[model samples]
Target: MRLKVIIPVVLISLSAGVLAFTKLGLSDDPPGRYEVIMNLVGQMLKEGHYQPKPIDDAFSKEAFNKYLRSLDVEKKFFLKSDIDRLAPLSTHIDDELKGAQLDCFRNINTIIKQRVAEASAIYPAILSQPFDFTKEESVVLDVDKVEFPADSVARYEAWRKMLKYRTLEKLTDLQETRDKSREDSVKNKTDQQLEAEARDKVKKVYDRYFERIKNRQDDNDRFSLYVNAITTTMDPHTDYFPPDEKRQFEEQMAGKFFGIGAGLKEEDGKIKVLSIITGSPSWKEGHLKVNDVIQKVAQGDKEAVDITGYPVEDAVKLIRGNKGTTVKLTVKSVDGTVKVISIVRDEIIQEETFAKSAVINGTHKIGYIYLPEFYSDFNDRNGARCAADVAKEVAKLKAEKVEGIILDLRFNGGGSLPEVVEMAGLFIPEGPVVQVRSRGGDAIVLRDRDKSVQYDGPLAIMVNEYSASASEILAAAMQDYKRAVIIGSQQTFGKGTVQRLFSLDDFYPVKDGQSLGALKLTQQKFYRANGGSTQLKGVSSDIVLPDPYYEVSERKDSDALAWDEIPKSNYEIWSNPVNTDNLKKNSEKRMANSAAFKLLNENLATLKKLEKQESYSLNLATYKAEQKVNTAALKRYDAVNDKVKELNITSMKVDLDKIGSDTTKIARNKDWLKARTKDIYLDEAVNVMNDLIAQTLPKMQRKQQ
Candidate 1:
């Protein structure tokens, strides 16, 4: 189980900061603008908190150089001339930043507007030109070049435009290809008719693209650009929040949001249902499923509006409404068949965010504590301390006399660092838990101040690829201390950098004099005492479990930061050493013989094969074929449930409602046990713990005898 960190207030502060920046009133003239910009830059350079290194003239220059290098034409996407034109401006920006001059804002705004105009003019030409890849000389620059800019806004906008144009160009090409295919399919068409059809198709494609570009020019793009500019100056974590997005950000951090009870993303030019919240109306109706693409949305009894190629925000607006209103969605499943689903808008309560626990086995009573996030309300001092709640659960488990514990951290993305440190301390006696290295070469060892270990017995931590940040810190600490057996998936999410938010309003003057800009700046790097940086190389499990991630994905293979090394620190190992090799062998043997494990492996294999599929045609035969494959996958999943019944495992009951609301009470009441009897991982963990106990308990008992 990986831990997820929640930074609720940060998002609010970021939004406030952005508003401040946009509202800042610097000056009417360019020199006065430069002065204002310089003053702002100087203040940030001197006082802005950063997770990486502190901002300085030298640091700014180095970053600027990196930005310039990234713009080389021989690079993957950017042109060399762009870098050449931008590099010299770095010094002015750096100086302005160093001096805290308000005038720098005007200078930056002017340069950005100019560069964007240049890029916009060149964009059509770049798209129209044909790439002669076969010509060896044509591919001029290496893709690995880096470019850094001192003016954060200019640099970010340039990259954003570059990427956006590339995406648009690719999408246009796809549309053209589809159009040509349709034109060719028309039977017995005259030359004139074919020409007309081709022209019409081209016109439609152009219109669609034009609409998309126009929509992108709206406030969303402006807000996004402003946010990115602020983030680039600070650490990546700090971001300016637009007022419109504040509510959504709050919902995300709180693990709850008011909407249509569905997660949406653009897929294949259509709004698709990524996941329906577990308790939402859609999930309850069982009409919406993953991979279902939404085609249209209609208000109560209103005509459906075709939403193909619609911007995500616009689509979201159509889907979201005040509670009690009905919204109808037309969806196309993976099979290419369409269906209509009507759901009333309502508050979606996220059960996964709350504290949930499960008992592993009836007799051994190994407790499973799943803390999704460290979420406390800003209004309350102890509102969202997940660690404290978990501690209370641990007390209950101890009273029930559980033999061991499994801390599930699979989807935990991380939350509060302090909460994580305190949680880690719960398992081990007071000691240094993690090491933080600052930019100025200062190293601090964060220790668990608690005098006593909450649960000193055998422990196991279950994590997956999604586990990140504070979760990684706790897991790394546990691994270092040898206090818990790390299990499941591959390596956890490798986000090791810390971030701090700064208000841009405090520096730059806003035109409106009402808004502020906030930057989430990366300040420091976290490291395990053993010396490996968790930045991109997340912690590897001690006892690797059979998971879909192994076949479908690898942690290091994902798009993440590069793994780098930092200085090592002296720290003590907290737990007695166990033979990891023996543990692995034991687990492997048990899994090989277990029928449940075999079934799980077969299901995972089928899932992997299905996941490889990408394209689907509109033809009926092709759609049916796709449906057959999907049906087969569904059957396989259903078969697992039947297999559970065959095993006669009383704990494998399918009634979710039977599971008590109070997880702690469920752990106590042995009669209502369901998960323990059939849980393969818990059974295995118990066997391993029992073996260890058998080996060591006799020595202590012999003295008493």
Candidate 2:
């Protein structure tokens, strides 16, 4: 995250019910509040975005389609006729963004409200009749695989197929239970009886879902949706934070959430799990994952609330509660399996987030350091910083007489920019770590001023798709300097663009000081010291280990900034560099022969196939047969690389003493080490370290002689 400036930005055009502000003072009556927000956001994006695309017909078409998708992702509500009527505004959106008229969003808002009413009546009516499970029909849940219905009749049929798919899904589960359970309540149920029950369950869920949609479809909600669509079209990171979200951002609920420790994002009106904080409740629970769709949230034994179509901030509010309180989440996994996960709310343990190291004993004494995120407390100057903690950890590992060190940045999503520059300094001599280029400015090098090197040993940095920004900066610097062996996923998370929030309130004065919300604008881009921008093409690893979650990387998104290069910064490579070609060759040979890697790759392929399987058969036998293959594949992949061989990992005596009598920290420390013990990547990293150590030993012997 980049440092944000909250000052008022007096741009060319600003308006609302209030007087319009431009070079020529107060203009006549402008369009309503919706148009005003769009214009301001449009102006700000053009002014601040690193590579702002012209808001032409292409941008308008993309924005228009994205907004419709965001509105009804399932293709359940709007008919093709509705879309056809609204199609003219698709090209007109560019005009709307420039303050011509907000007919696109305004008209869509009117149509979506009417369609929601129509859908409310359609689903239950379809569920009223019994579905024929023996029918040889299938339904595709993926909206891209299907199109909007042509008319009211086609819309009703579409509704029926979707409901039938849900009913078929429930029926399969019920049948499975009936076949396995010995209890008469379940055992005595007939096939017909189970089908009826499935419909009942489907109806129950849709009932709550529709009720939620009706409650949340106010004018403000629709406008927020429209504004967000416009912002996100520029890039995935650029976003419009409505008033509630802005409040949460100001409150910094990200650090001190009193709920399950899973971060969520609103994707096409569906709340999807973004990242689960390590050592948090969700991570410890081990059920919630990175891409799970949260269907509903329930507290205690009360009725569950359908969170679909609800903004992420609202869903988060439902999830957060008093510590120790239980929040049951009904989530659908990426494999199309749905289940309820109960997680207790707890505050994040601060120590768990700090840099921690352990000794890995083998042929070569190696040190393993885990830094979850590059954390820093902005308010307190004396507060914890990752650079300081990592320096201390390196020192600890140095005391242990470690031959080499491995810094695990696998899941680090980046933090303070200053911290990364300083952390990069720890390994190599004073140099430029990363380059930053603001919109309409020359690229400036951010350097580590201190000439002192902290740990000059056989160093290896581990990364995955989750690593980003500051993590990429450090990794890229090390890779460019040939200071460390880069290992893990194909590339790091390419979130190179820097973002800052601009206050809409600063632009427009509100009565009673009510919030006008803020827009998170991408103002800068990051470049590696080698001149290549780590924009869409992230820092590629020296050794590419296949990551199962590779689909979640930045390149998967169409709107990510394109990869570009600048003039390379002047710097010296490491004086004594490890032979990377030999190291890579040896590692590749090991992975090629390893059974675990082979099976893991095979299972990744299986999952990829299953991911593309959005179509489900309505026939019970056919559906069950297809799901059986999916279930088997998912189960195999679940524990594919659970453990290769547990490594001899132990905590440092000093760190153990620091834990002292604190049972909570002691327990957490145990869990932390226990998780890494089975890590195949870490295991391979140690092997790679041994190779580097082998390569370095002869040189050391020659030096001593």
Best by lDDT: 2
Residue 410, model 2: Cα distance from true site in angstroms: 2.2
TM-score for candidate 2, please give it: 0.81
Q: Write the per-residue lDDT of candidate 1 for residues 541-602, one digit (tens) a residue.
A: 87766665552222343323356675666666764544466677887787788776787788
Using TM-score, give the best candidate's number. 2
Give each model's whole-structure lDDT: 0.58, 0.82
TM-score of model number 1: 0.56
Predicted candidate 2 versus true structure: per-residue lDDT over 1-705, tens digit per residue: 111222244221111112123321123563455665777787777656667899899998998999999999988889999899998889987787776777788799999999999889888888988888888998888888899988889888888988898998899899999999999989999999999999999997877677667757688978898888888999998889877677455335123446788879977668999887767999899999999999999996789998877877679878877679999999999999999999988875445667889999998899999998877655446667889989999999999999999999998988677788889999988889998887667888888788889988899999999999888999999999988989999888898976666667766544455666888777778799899988888889998888876677888989888888999999999877767899999999998998888888889898887788877788888989888998888787767556387899999999999888866567778998998888888888999999999998888788779
RMSD of each: 11.7, 8.1
lDDT score of residue 124 within candidate 2: 81
Using all chains and alpha carbons, the TM-scores for the candidates as numbered come to: 0.56, 0.81
